[model samples]
Target: MQVQFGVLGPVVAWDGAGDAIALKGPRHRAVLARLIIARRRVVPVFRLVEDLWTDPPADAVGAVRTFVAALRRALEPERPPRAPARLLLTEGPGYALRAEPGAVDAWRFEQAVAATATLPPKEVFARLEEALGWWRGPAYAEFADQPWVRAERSRLAELRLHAVERQAEARLGLGLAAEAVPDLDAHVAEHPWREDAWRLLALALYRTGRQGDALAVLRRARTLLVEQLGVDPGPGLRGLEADILGHAAHLAPAPGPGGAAGRVWAQTAAAYDRTVPSGARVRLESTVGLLRNLAVTGGSGLQAARRHRVAAVAAAEELGDAELTARVIGVYDVPAIWTRVDDPEQAAQVVAAAERTLTALPPGGHEAARARLLATIALESRGPLPQARRAGRTPSARGPQAARQAEEIARRLDDAALLAFALNAVFMQTFHRAGLAPRRDEIGVELVALSARHGLATSEVLGHLIRLQARSALADFPGADHHATAADRLAERHELPLVGVFTQWYAALRTAATGPAAAAEAEAAYRNAAARLDGAGMPGLEHGLLPLALLCLRVQHAQPAQAEEHTDWGPYEPWARPLALLAQDRRSEAAAALRKVPDPPHDLLFEALWCLTAQAAIAVGDRQTMERAYIQLTPAAAELAGAGSGLLTLGPVSKHLSDLATALRRPR
Candidate 1:
């Protein structure tokens, strides 16, 4: 059976009989459009409800279901015997389209262009030409007045232009200069002000040895530029024109210093080494400049790798010392991996150089320098224990240990800000390992006080403080409120995305102590936090506190899907599975899942608490299990109680906990 989907150009379709299938009504078209693009994937009913009704009247869900049914019927007017679902099928919690790959015209266009990348120049040109020929006019022209369709049409148009540009480049590279010239000229006539197209045209003309024509083209471009925007051609365009006139050899683009985009890449690398923070305005500006430069000098494959190495080394040099340079290079490794440009040999060599530099440092001569060296080593090695051990040692027992000596020097030098920064890094390592919470808290508080005194608003410090406070409250430690309030105020002032997450966790804990209404409030807060987090591009893997928040909120809300979506237990898959199963009310499955969680390290309080909570929830008849959970959580409960929330009543695992317990107690 034949069915066509079109998002690019006019809305058109044909049925199995090859008869025109007309789609009428704006909203109906929109519903179909969304389903087609999100093809095969089940877009949740709630999301569709939101789309169809901006201020959905009561029965929004029902209205959405009606729309789905209507769309399905429209697509399959004459359902054949034993035929598969024509357009849509009900899947878990939502609907999915059943269209085959390339059944959609939009998908066909993309496939054609992607195939062109591997084909010969003539073939590439032909494929793109055919793909472009599919467009009958402005995309979804009948629905152009609709906001979503308009935006989608704009995106498709951009894609078409990109395909054209790439095809033109291939044609020119194949020495088909005269062949590309007319099409490029037509493109220029349509988009006369686009400098890249003009540049391509000029290059194509020059390549055919039409030097005079190329110069004339540049002259026309300059005139157009002056008339349109009252500006001369940019440096690159002007340089190209000069080259053509002088008959000079074409210049090869040079790899940037350290392979960074532009001058600022080198500058930012230097600044990073000099103790400047990551998100500073100066560093960001430099990063932007470097990116712009890199775009201008396009390199592929091995050339790209060489350019990145150059950039890394330049950054290392700007950082000043050998260790700092190595650390800067290590930072480059993350992007290199994503871009598939990582060089293990180069990385190892840099690390070796850093170690040598550290080894060669004179005893007790420079405390700050020594600390910097150690910090760089710690960062490069990715071994926190080794770093902690190294940091624990003094440069000389009597003369000056690096950490202590560095602290003293910071005090004497009136550099509290730097002192705070140094201490924060140390705290990060300590907090990650077992049995270091007290020390972590002390150092974190000190850092916060120092930062506050120095008029600093550090998100890093605030985030650490929030985690420490939550831990302290859980462990029943002192000063939880002070830390919690401090974290809350800082997060509110900055509109920090993570703060909402922590706030929800705090609310859940409070609710469990108080009552169901409080628990419901916590659930609402968690939902709000999740919505806010949806678009924010926080690091996917390094969400240290978010998992903890999700665990707490899951108990409060009893929503398994929400819990699963946020749980990121790196390498602890077995442990996470039980928690997920339990949250979903699969009692026996959840209990079975728990055997996978390895025994916790003795000092890891939170892990123990979670285990106890799980065990108690799974074995309701066993008073011993509940008692043990109470015993483990008592200290944490007391600490939170002391922080002035009366809800800190600890015992028979509250309503959320009781639900799990009840589920577990039911007949198998």
Candidate 2:
């Protein structure tokens, strides 16, 4: 059987079947309520006696004992004569209530509100609404005049109010400012001292085009604070007031779902579904390409994408149209930088399709289409399949060969988009190795110049993102931040929401690198970024990316890295596990583990893995691994380790290299 308690309204208890436990009299109810407010802590019998009454009779202690007995009988009706109470237990000199999680409505309500910090607007609003529903009325309403319950009651009331404000904040985030206005108006009117509520009400009014009303609300707030509280309005309220007067551009509502580009793609997909036939070979082929690109970048479901890919490839093959096949294969959407191919099986299918088309075309003909297919092969082949890795299959040079052929053809064609495409393929092949930031930097430069000249918005965003990663790796904070800003602006303009995702990650990385003063803030920032990434539905890009970054941050701060280590880091587990072991002070275990791990793979995360290894080696005093890591990391000695991921870093590579040298008895 189960039991539940509620003090959100009058003190009450319900058994497993929802029948209210008859807490006999006022004194019995008071005792039960006091015990509930103890929050599982032991409440001394003497303290309860003083709180229950101002005056005592000769048998007052006996009276207290009788009240406890009655309460136990009501709360635990099934207890045998000799059995002790399960929910309420007597300990030492007091009694404690052992309610489970969610048994108490007040506790459950608080937890729900606390969890909304990192959620998206829609989720935040839903959760906050659920939390507020737990409040039946004033907390401990039956004991409003009692001094004993005063503090707890006040605390819960304030928490409920704060939840209301948080919900309104979420509403504003969801662009529902108009809907938020009514409740906020009531909230501020009833609690005029709450500047946050006032600010939200004003902002909501302003968003709803009531600028004069918004300004008036702020003015009223200022007057209330100055006259009653004897302080000017806080920074937030004052700042909002100033922004309203100036009509700041940022105050406008955010762009609707997916911005302009997303709406267009959605409309197009809908129109195609409504009117286009599967037998329209050419149109279907183009639609399939667009769907595949969306699947990679985001805004498309995986099963649907796979279905489209299969159907389109089959249709093109059945028709024996090489051009349509090439179109389908060549148009795989290039995702944001650092987004490795997650569905390698799908990639292999595309490669097979391209090869079949290549065989159909004459050796010297279809150069443009051939170049695109070759670049696709190069990009897709860069990340080896998990099954191949498990089988210990050595990588072939096919990726590089295809990339080179693509680049040669693109250069001959004198097409900027084609050249940029080939360069991206080359980037995929080369970027996985450690100490290759300089090469990557050169590619980034060419990408930016060429893409900007041709006004390739997607490519331009990609260029800035690549440059941001390279610059961060090369220890140029200013350059990295500059590119990050540019990438953010370009992504917003182009409706590339995922681009902003990476840029936000870069901001967190910068915060984490700012040292101990920002450690807590940095952790919060990383958590929020991870939440946003998850919410965006880009799981492939999110997997292990933030966890690796967090591990790097914790390692630098000399904090406990055990929590981060326990996360399911997928392929990066080998690099992160040893560091976590060292963090727990298991030095010999860390050293042995490091010895068993393979050399870090040459991929986008190569530098990150090596740098993590370098940290573990330093801690475990594994001089040999130190020397190996040193050799790989020394080339980019001035750079910050792991910045290529745009999420987190393990301080500077130079710092680790210097330490490795010192340990190795060599000069820096």
Best by lDDT: 2
Mind giving the per-residue lDDT tens digits that candidate 1 earns over 345-373?
A: 44334445445666655566655555444
**Compared with the true structure, what per-residue lDDT tens digits does model 2 show for residues 125-243?**
99988779777889988899999999999999999999999999988777777668789999999999999999999988787667888999999999999999899999999899999
> Model 2 off-target regions past 4 Å?
1-277, 292-307, 386-396, 563-565
| CA lDDT of each prediction against the hidden true structure | 0.53, 0.80
Candidate 1 runs further than 4 Å off: 1-357, 360-364, 375-414, 430-441, 459-514, 535-537, 540-572, 579-593, 600-668
What 10-residue stretch in candidate 1 is worst by lDDT?
333-342
Clashing pairs in 2: 432-602, 432-603
**Residue 198 miss distance in model 1 (angstroms):** 6.5
Count of clashing residue pairs in every prediction: 15, 2
RMSD list, candidates in order: 16.8, 15.1
Instruction: Output candidate 2 Cα RMSD.
Output: 15.1
